[model samples]
Target: MTRTESLANRLQEVLLNGRWIANTNYKHQLEDITWEQAIKKVGSLNTIAALTYHVNYYLAGILNVFRGGELEIRDRYSFDLPPICSKEDWDNLVDEFLTNSEAFVLEVSKLPDHKLDMPFVDEKYGTYLRNLEGVIEHCYYHLGQISFLKKLIFA
Candidate 1:
């Protein structure tokens, strides 16, 4: 398979799910964590809630730009960290996160091969691959943090 195809497939496996491996994904370190447990921040890192928001931020940010949505920072608030004091709120945010993630994956899958080589510059990351793989990497980076925070809050 082509590099983009491989990345797209794996990204679907990891990010399309409604939630991360919290104790349920056997190989995932944070398995078994309750959603409530996912929202608490026991240390220096952002709570799973915040990390999830950041993931959504990049997902929406990239997808939006691909769809002719502007790259202005002010317009990127949909993915910013939100307060996660209650289970319902956390559930809602998580759902939104999943929805955006799925949308991003689908969007990236449709990108033309040439478009992948294009350059995109913004305040967030100065230069980036203008395609699906970059989006997938951004998602994985934040997911790593979310999974790590899950361990702290739960295990």
Candidate 2:
């Protein structure tokens, strides 16, 4: 496989499933999470639900970019999660994450390595490689928080 394909695989491992850091992925960490637990804030920390939305918000926005759509998402609304007071709401959010992450993996796999060095939207935003890798790192950072919050809230 090409280097871009390898990066895509790593991205999938981080977002969905496979042995990465801590031997777990974001999806597995979220498994069996109840709405109450997802929304529970440990001290002043953000809720698991909010963090989940924050990660997927960027993934979905980038997915749109892959499909020739605009990257219209703003950082100001990244943490604006919908209410998770109901089971349906939580389930929907998880579903969206799964779908968006999978689609992101596929779209990323289609890119040629050469595209990674090109400007993503504008030169000011940096290259696709930088942004994509940044997102992967971002997920790992928040995945740690999600794991900690899970233990604190569910324990």
Please identify model 1 stretches exceeding 4 Å from their true place.
1-3, 17-35, 74-80, 121-132
Model 1, range 4-100, lDDT digits (tens) per residue? 5555566676675433332222123223445677666575666666666666676666777878877754434744665667767767766776677
lDDT of 2 by residue, 10-111 (tens): 888998887756688888988789988999889999999999999999999999999999989999999988778798999999999999999999999999
Question: Best-fitting candidate, measured by TM-score?
Answer: 2
Please report, in order, the local distance difference test score of every candidate based on alpha carbons.
Answer: 0.60, 0.91
Q: Over all chains combined, what TM-score does candidate 2 have?
A: 0.97
Q: Model 1 — which ten-residue stretch has the worst lDDT?
A: 21-30
The 10 consecutive residues of candidate 2 with the worst lDDT sum are 15-24
TM-score of 1: 0.71
